[model samples]
Target: MKRTALSAAILLATSPALADTPNTDDAQTLETVQVTASRIAQTVDETLASVTIIDREEIERLQPQQFTDLLEGRAGIETSQNSAFGKTSSVYTRGTSSDHTLLLIDGVRMGSATTGGASWQFLPPEEIERVEIVRGPRTSIYGSDAIGGVVQVFTREGRKGPPKVDAFVGGGSFNTWETGVGVAGGTENTNYSLSVSHFETDGINVQDGVGDEDRDGYDNTSLATKVSHRLDNGIEVFGSILYSEGESEFDSTEGDDYTDYVHAAIRAGLRLRLTDRWDTELSVSHSRDENDRYTDGSFASQYDTKRDSVDWLNEIFLTDHLLLTAGLDAREDRIDVDDPGFLGAEEYAETSRYNVGGFGILQADLGRHLLEGSLRYDDNEQFGSKTTGQMAWGIQVAEAWRLRASYGTAFKAPTFNELYHPDIGFFRGNPDLDPEESETFELGARYSVEPGYLDVSIFETRVDNLIAGFAPPENVEEARIRGLEIEGGYERGQWLSRASLTLLDAEDRETGNELPRRSPVTARFDLDRQFQRFSAGGSVIAKSRSYNDRNNDIRLSGYGLVNLRASYQIAPEWQLQASVKNVFDKDYETALGYNQPGRAAFVKLRYQQR
Candidate 1:
C-alpha cells in the first residue's frame, strides 16, 4: 500500500500541464534566493522544498524584540516562551520535537549537545543580516538532528560602497531599554563589519502562586565582527565571531534563583577557486555555552559545554546542467557540569563525545525538470554508524506553476543528559537508549505571477524509538505527524500583503492521543502601505487550542493577537519607528502557567548612512 501511494504521488507530481498562461503586461517582481534547501545557492523557485527568507529590510520593519518574536508568524513553525522577554523558549517545526531542528550560523553549527537545542534567546538581532528556514527532513545534506528542518542565520557583512555607520536607542514598558551601533564597509579586496548591542528589561512576575513577589528581570550584552579578504589569485579568507553574556532572574522553588550565562562562537574559513569547474572550501569553528546558577547570592550549579568542528567541502561543475558537491565534517563535544551536593544521590561531572560524517549531493536541471539527490554517513563515538538519503523531483507544469515531491530519512541521537545523568529521586537516565529515527514524504506546488507568488505543501512524518522521561529515560514511544502549509505574498504600487496558514494532525501511535503542545491550526496575516518616507502596517496571528501533557487531559485555550507598526524618515539619515503589540491586551498562555505579555508600546530613534 505504501509503495502504491508513493508511486501515485510521483505520477501526479509529474503529470502533464493543463494550460500555459503567461502574463504579457509588464509588472515588478521580486526574486527570492535560498541556500539551506540544497546546501548550495539557488533561488527558491528552483529549489524543491518549502523555504522562507527573512531579509534585513523585513527584520527592521518587524522590529522583533527577541529571536522567538521574529519567527512566530511563519508557516510550519510554532514557539512557546516561559515569559515575555528573555526566558526559556522552544520552537517546534512541522509538529516535531524542539530538538529535531538544526541551527546554523554562517554554515557553522551553534548549540549545546547536552541540551540538544540552541540558545536562541541570546542571539542578537542587531547583528543579523538574514535568516533562511527550510521546512522538512534534511538529514541527507546535514547529518543528524534535522528531522524537522534547518534554520541558518547569516551575520552582517560588508557591502561594496562607502563606509556606513548606524545607531539606535529605544525604551518602552517594563522599564526596558535597547541600544546598538554598527559599522560596515568594503573595498575591492577587503571587507569588514562590527556591531555591539545591549538590552535590559525589568520584566514582570513570571511565576504563578509563588512565594516571592519580586519581578524577574534580564540583561544582555553582545558583540559581532566579521572580516574577509580576497587575494588576486582567486583565493579568499574570511572569519567571524559572536559573543554574548547575560544575567536572568527566574522563579525556582529551591531559592531566589538567577543565572549568569555566556554564549560564543568563532569561525574561520578559506575558499579556493581551483579551476573553472571546481571550487573548494575549508573551515574550522568553535562554540561554547556556559551557565552558572546562584541562589540568594550563593553558588548553586554550573554547566559548560564546548564544541569544535572542521569542514572540508568541494563543488564540481560536471556540465552546464549538472552539479556535484561533497563534504566531510568532524565535531567534538565536551561538557562539564558541577552540582556536587545539589542532588540527593547524583553528582554531575564531565564527559566528551565525537562524531565524523561524510555527505554528497547531486543536482541536475533538464529543461523544465529539476532533480536533486543527497546521501550522508555518520560514525559516532557512542552510536556505531548511521546512513541517510533523500531524493527530490520538480517539474514546471506551466509558465507560472511548478510541482515538487520529496522523500527522506532522518535520525536524532539521545542527548548527554538523557543518556548519562545519574539517578536522583524519581528521575534517572538510561544509558541503553537508542537513537530515534524518522521517515518523511512531502508534496508541494508553487504558483507565481508578476507581483506575487503562492506556495502550498502536504507532508507526513513517522517517528520510531522516541524517547520519553517517565521516572527514567526510555524509548517506548512512537509518533505520526501529518500537516499542510500554505503561504503567499503580494506587492503592487505602495501596498503589500502577506499571509500563511498551517494545519497539523500530530499524535502518539501507542496511546492514540494528541501530541503535547501541538496546535491543530495556526494562521497569520499582514498588510502594509508606504507613502514617500512614511509606512504603516498591521498584523494578525491566531492559533487553535492544544494539550499540555502527553495524556491530552490538560488544555490551553486558543487566542488571537493584533499588532500595529509605523515608521517615518525624519531626515535623510534619521528615522522614527514605533510599534504596539497585543493591541487588545488579550490574556493568554502559550505554555501552561506562564502568562504571555499584554498590550505594550515602544518607540525608537535611528541614524544610518550608506
Candidate 2:
C-alpha cells in the first residue's frame, strides 16, 4: 500500500499539466549547479556521483534547529547524539565510522585534529546558504578522510539585486530563544553579504538516571561575511569568513562536565580565465577549532587545532565533449593540548604534521554516455605516501532514464590524539598506527520526469586496517558494509514532497558482529503545501534498531518521529512561522543511556526588505 501511494503521487506529479509548469523555488531542477561533487561547477544531471543539495530556500522552509537535525534523515546518513540539543553528535555515512566522513566550509576543511570530527553542535544553520552532500569515496578530490563521503557547506552569498536586509527572532521549547539578521546585495561585478546570529536554550536533563537533574543549558554566537568582485578581463577575487563561539553542558561519569568552544575559518581565492577553454583558481585558507572543558566549574583541559592550506587548480576544455582538471594542495595541521591533570604533564602536548597532494580528473560527455576518472597522490609527514583513484560511468538508457556505476578508494589519517596522547591506564595513543583505507563500488539508476525524479543505488564498501580502541589505538579491526538507498522528490503547482529510505548491513569482519551505532534501516518522508502567502508542511523519520557497543551488547530500540511546520506572510515584509517536533512524544535514544528530547514547540517572526 505504501509503495502504491508513493507511485500514485509520482504519477500525478508527472501529469501533462504539472510537467509543463516552470521550476519554482519549491522544486528540484535538473539544471541546478553543483561544485562539491567534482570540485568544479556542473549541472546535477552532468555529475556521475550520487549527490544531494539542500539550498537556502529549503533551509528556511525546514528551519532545522541544529546541524544534526538538518542531516538526520538524509539518504546514506545516520546521526547519533548523546542527548538533546547542543550535545556531542556524530554522523556516519554509508554505514562507515563517524570519522570516515569529511566536513568542509566553503571548501576549507573544518574539524578538530584531536577529536577526528567536526563540532556539529556549534555550526549554526543561519550561517549557511547551501549544503552539498556527495555520497561516495572522493579521495581523488579530497586527499584523506573521504572514505564514506564528503559534505561541503557553502556560506551565505550576495544575490544580484538591490540591497536588502532580513531578520528573524524566535523562541521554542526548553526555554530556547533565537535571533539573526543579515544584509546582502550585488551589482554586475561586485557582491557582498554579512550576517550575525545568537541562540540559547535551557535544555533537558542529559543524565536522567545519574542523579544530576539540573537543566543543561547552551548558548552560541555566530558571524559570517562574504564578498566577491569580478573584473571585465575574466578575473575574480573573493574572500569569506565564518566564526562561532559557544558553550554547552553535558553529563560525565566522573564530574559535571561542560565545554566552551570557538571555531573560525577564513578563505580567499582568485579565479582567472586565461582563455575561453582554460581557467584556473588559486586559493588559500586557515581554520581553527579550540575547546576548553570544565569539570565542576573549573577548567580541566584544553585542546586547540589549527590548519592552513593552499591549492592551485586548473581546468581545460580539450574539446566540446572532453574536459580535464588538475590541482595541487598543501596543508599543515598543528595541535596544542593542555591536560595537566589528565595526562600528568609527561606526554607530548603539542604536535604538527604536513601533507602535500596532487590530483587530476578527466571527464568525457558523448552522446548518451558520460565517463569520469580521477587520480591523486599524497605525501604525508606521518603516513608517508599513498595513492587513490576512482572511475565512474553513466549511460542515458532512455529519454528520462540513466544507469551509472562507480568504483573508488579512500583513506583516513590518524588524529593527533589517536597518535600521540599519553597512556593513562584506561586510554592511550599509539604512535605506530597506520592510516585506515577502504574500497567502494556502487551501481545506481535514475528516472526523471517533468516535475519529479527518482534515484536508487546499491553499494558495498570493505575497509582494512580499521582503527579500534585498545587503550592505544590499533589496526585490529575490519568492516564490510553494504547498503541500498532510494530517494525521490516531486514538486508541482502548490505541492511538494520528498522521500528517502536506506537499508544497511554493516559487520565487523573480525568477530562477525554488527558494527556499533549503525542502524539496519532508516526512512524519511516530507510533504508541503503552499497557498498564496501561507504554507504548511510535515515530516516523518523512522530508524531501525542498532547496537551501541561493538560486541552488540547494548541495544538501542528503533523509533519514529513526526514534525509539523507552518508559515504565514503577514505583509510584504513580515511573516510568522511555527513548528512542533516529536508530535507523538515518542521516547527513544540515538545512543545508550542518553535521554532524547520529547515534544517541542517553537514560534518565530521574520522581516525582510523587498
Candidate 3:
C-alpha cells in the first residue's frame, strides 16, 4: 500500500511540528521583501497576505519537469491537468475560478486575452529563478483577475562579476529528453544573463474511450534573457525577454488532432531617485499568445491574442515609520480569430478593448503594530467604472507569535472569447456579460523560531456575477468559498521537512452544490536529509474525493502519491541527479476523463562553473 508516505504526512500533521520553506532556506524570510502582494516591496513579516517563496535552489532541488509541478497543493492551491505534460491545465487558488488568479512575469501581467488564463505548460521552468505565491485577494493593489490571488514568476537575475556558465541534460520515462545551458556576467554598473533550453517527449494516450490509440507527443524550444544598468546619479534601466514555441498532440476524438503555439513576453523599465525621500518608476510591457490548430495534418483554425501595458508608480516616505504610494495602470487587449462573423457581422469580429486604473496605498509601522490601507478605481471599456479597497492590521501577540486580519475586494473582467468570440458552430458569444466581483475576509496567526515556522489562515470569499458556460456563456451564477490552510517547515541538523494541509467548503450558491473539482481535504509533506556531498528526499501528496460536475453526482475518488529524489556530487562543480515519481504507481485522476502519468523515472547530469 501507499502507507509509508501517507503515514509520514499524518505524523507530521499530528506532531505539532512544521510549512514555508525549510529553515535552511527560509531562516531569512522575515528580511526578504516581496512586491506582488502590496504592489510595493515589503518585508515578509509586514505583508498581511499569506505568501510563499520558491527560489532557484529549491527549484533545482525539486527536479520538476513542468512549471506547474512546482505549484501543486501548496497552501490553498490545487491543479488539475487535462492529460500529462504539455496539455491544458487548470490551477485553482482557494476554491476560486482558474482565471480568477493572475499570473505575472517579472512584474508584467501575462496570459491569454482570449482564453483568460495563462498557458502554464509553455512557460519554461528552466528560465525561472524564483516564484512568489500570495494567497487571498489583492485587487485593491493589482486590479482585475486578482479575485483568487497572484503568482509571479521572476527570471534569473544577472550578477556583477566574472562570467559563469551552467548546463544540464536529462531524460526519463515516456521517451522524454531535456537540456539547457546558461551564462551570466557583467561590469560593476551593468549585468546580463541569458539562457536557452529544449524539451520533447512521446507522451501518453491522454484519454479513455479515445478514437486515436497512438501516444500523443510534445516538443518545445525556449529562451530567456535580462539586462540591467545603473547610472552614477542613482538612475537605473532594465529590460527582459522570454519566448517559447511548442507543438503538442492530444486526444480530441477527431483523429490526428494537434496544435502549434508561440508565446512571448517583453518588458523594459526606468527607475529614478527624484529625491532622497521620494522615488519614481515607469515601465512598459507586451505579451502575445498564439495557437494554430490542425487535424489530419491540415490547418483548421488560428487564435492570436496580444496585450500591451504601461504603468507609473511613485513612493514617498512621509515619516520615519509611515509611507505613501500611488500608481497608474493602463492596458489594451486585442485578439484575431480565423472564423465566421460574430452576430452576423461581415467576418470574424476583429475585437479589442482597453482598461485604465488608478490606485493609492498608505502604510504605518508603529513598533509592534502595523497597519495598511489601499484603494483603487478601474474603468473598463465595457464594464464602465468600478472601485475596490482593502484594510489590514497586524500585531505581535507574543514574543514568538503574531496575529493579523484583513478584508479585501476584487474583480475579474470578461475574457475576449467570452465577450466577442466568432461563430464556432456549436456556441455563440455573449457580449453583454458583466464582470465577476468578489469580497474576502481573512484572519491569520503565525509562530516562528530559529529552526522552523508555522502559520494558519482562515478565509471566506463570496463571489457575485460568476460567468458560467451555457448555450452561451452568462453571468447568472454565484459562489461562496470558506477554507482553512495550515503550512509549516522545519530544518534541524541534517534533516529538513515541510508540510501543508487545506480544508475547503466551496459551494455554488445557485445550485446548492459543491464547486466542481474542488477537493474537501488535501495535504502534502516533504522530507530531505543531506549527508556531505550526497542528499536524498521524498514527498507525499494526498487528497480527498471531489466532484467532476457542479451537481456533485459524479465522484472522483481520493488518492495518494509518493515521489523520491537523490543527488550525488561527482566533483567540485559537477553533480548527478535522479528521481522516481509516483513510486507506488497509484491509479488516480485529478480530472474525470484525463489520464494521469504514472511510475516515471529520470536522471540528470549537471555542470557549473564556480
Candidate 4:
C-alpha cells in the first residue's frame, strides 16, 4: 500500500511536469475556495475573505530550506525565531499575537493545548505539496485559535506505478549538511509512499559573550509515510504518520542552560463517497512533545506533554452551486512541567476541549457576478458556544478587470499557558478572561495582461478583547486592534516579480499606547528569471523597528536580508541546485534580545527516474 501511494504522489507531480499550469481551464480559474473558509468548499468569487495559494512548484523554485522561511515577510505577516534550533518559532499575522495564527497539516489542526500555537520546525520542507493561506477571520468554520488567519500544509501523496525513488545530499557554509530520500509505487487499487530527511548545522554566535561562531549548533531528523487502498465498495481507506526529532543550542546568560527539544506525532484518516455529490471523512491523531534545557549541569528545566484528537466531516451537495457541511471535533491534552526557576516546585497540569460544530454555505454564479454566504456554530467546553458568519461578492467587469469584496467575523480562546502560570510564589489563572473576537473587511482587484498577471488588495480589521499581559494594578486588560493592509504583485512570462508592503497601527484601547513588539512597517520583494535549463532568483525582506517590552521600555532596530538561488539541469534525470542565504551577512534579530545567523551557502545534486 505504501509503495503504491508513493507512486501516485510522484505521478501527480510528474504528470504536469512539462507545464506549470493544469490542463483544465476550470482549474486555472481564480475562483474562491469554500473549504478552507467555511468547512464546505465554496468558490472564493462569492465569499468575503482573503486567501493565497502557493503551489509546490513555487516552493521548489524558491528553495526555502525551512518551512517558516516560505512565509516570512509575506503581506501582513511577521515571523519570530529567537533560537538557533527554531524551538520557539511563532508567526503573527495582521498585527495579531503570535498564537493567533492557526496551522493545519493535511487539513488537521496542529495547535498545542499548552501554548495554543503550532510547532513550525517539526515538518520537512521537502515533503510539502502545497500551501494555502487565508488572512482575516475564519473561526466560523475552523473553531478557536484562528483569530488572525489559517495556514494549511498539504503533503505529497502517491500517484503513479513501477516503484520510483529519488535522493539528494548536500553540504554548505556554517558546516550545514542535509540529505533526503523518498520512494513510491504500487499495484492497482493500492499505493504507498515513504520519505526521510535530516539536517545539521554549526551556527553563528550573534552574542559576543555567548561563545564563538561554531559553538551554536542544531540537528533535526524527520520521517513520514502514507498508505492508501481503494475498497470494492468505492470507499478509500488511508493512513499517514509523521515523526520528527530536533535539538538546538542557543546563547544563555548563565552559560549553563541552552535550549533543546524533541517531539513525535501520528495521524490516520478514512474517506468515502456516499453518492456522486456527497462525501464523508473520519480522522484521528495523537502527538507527544518532550523538552529539556540544561546549562550548568543540574537540569535547568523540562516540559512534557501529549495530545489526542478525533474529527468527522460530512459534505452534501444540493447542486453544483450550493453545498452544506457539518462536523464535530474533540481533543484532550496533558502537560508536566519541572522548573527550579519558577517558584522552585514541580507542577503537573492537564486540560481538555470538546467542540461540536455545524456549518452551511450558499454559492451562486450568474453572468459576471458571483455571490457566497457562510454560517457556523461551535459549542466548546470552556468558552461555551458562539456563532460566526461571512458574506462576499465578486464581479468580472471585463476580460482584464476583476473585483472582489468580503466581510467575516472570528473568535479565539486563551491558551493554557496564558490562563495558568506559576510566577515566583504566585499562581495566576484567568477564569474570567473573555474570548477574543474580530471583524474584517477587504477589497481586491486583479488585472491580467499580456506577459504578466497583476493583483492588488486593501483590507481593514477590527478586534475586541485583544489578549495581553498586564501589570500589578490592572492585573489584565482587554484591548483592541484596528489596521490596514495593502499588497500587490505581478508575474511576467519569463521575468517574475512580486512585492508586498504592510503598514499597521495597533494600540491598547485602555491605555491608548502602541502595542508592544509590533512591526508597523514590513515589506518583501522577489525577482527571478528562467531560460532554457538554468533558473535564478533572489528575495529581500525588511521590517521597521519595533517596541520591546509591554511598557515600551526599549526599542529594537530593524534589519534587512538578501537571498539568492540558482538551479541547472545536469541531465534528463539529474539536476544541480545552489543557494546563498543572508547574502550580505547582516547581523539581525527577529526578537528583541536573541541572536540570528550570518550568511550561508548550500549546494545539492538530485537524481530522479524518468
Best by lDDT: 2
For 575-604, candidate 4 gives per-residue lDDT tens digits of 898989899999877776677767878898
Estimated TM-score for each candidate: 0.94, 0.94, 0.94, 0.87
Residue range 1-610, candidate 2, lDDT tens digits: 1122212112111010111122234345665656677776655666788887787788888878888888887899999998877888898999998888888888788889988998777789988877878898998888899999998887877766788998999998999999999999888777789999999999988877664678888898999998877788767777889899989987654456789989888888887767766777788999999999888778888999999999888777788777787889999999888897778766564499999999999888888998999999999998799999999999999988889999999999988888888878888888889999999999999887769888899999999999888598899899999999998889998999988899999999999999988999999898999999999999999999999998898999999999999999999999999999999999999988888889999999999899
Candidate 1 lDDT by residue in tens digits, 333-437: 988787765464465433888999999988887888989899999998887799999999999999999999999999998888787776776766677788899
Q: What are the root-mean-square deviations of the candidates from the true structure over C-alphas?
A: 6.9, 6.5, 7.4, 5.1
**Could you give the candidate ranking by lDDT, starting with the highest?**
2, 3, 1, 4
Which whole-number lDDT from 0 to 100 does residue 592 have in model 2? Answer: 87
**What is each predicted model's overall lDDT from 0 to 1?**
0.81, 0.84, 0.82, 0.67
> What value does the lDDT take at residue 226 in candidate 2?
88
CA lDDT, candidate 3, residue 238? 79
Output the worst ten-in-a-row residue range by lDDT, candidate 2.
11-20
RMSD of 1: 6.9
Best model number under TM-score = 2
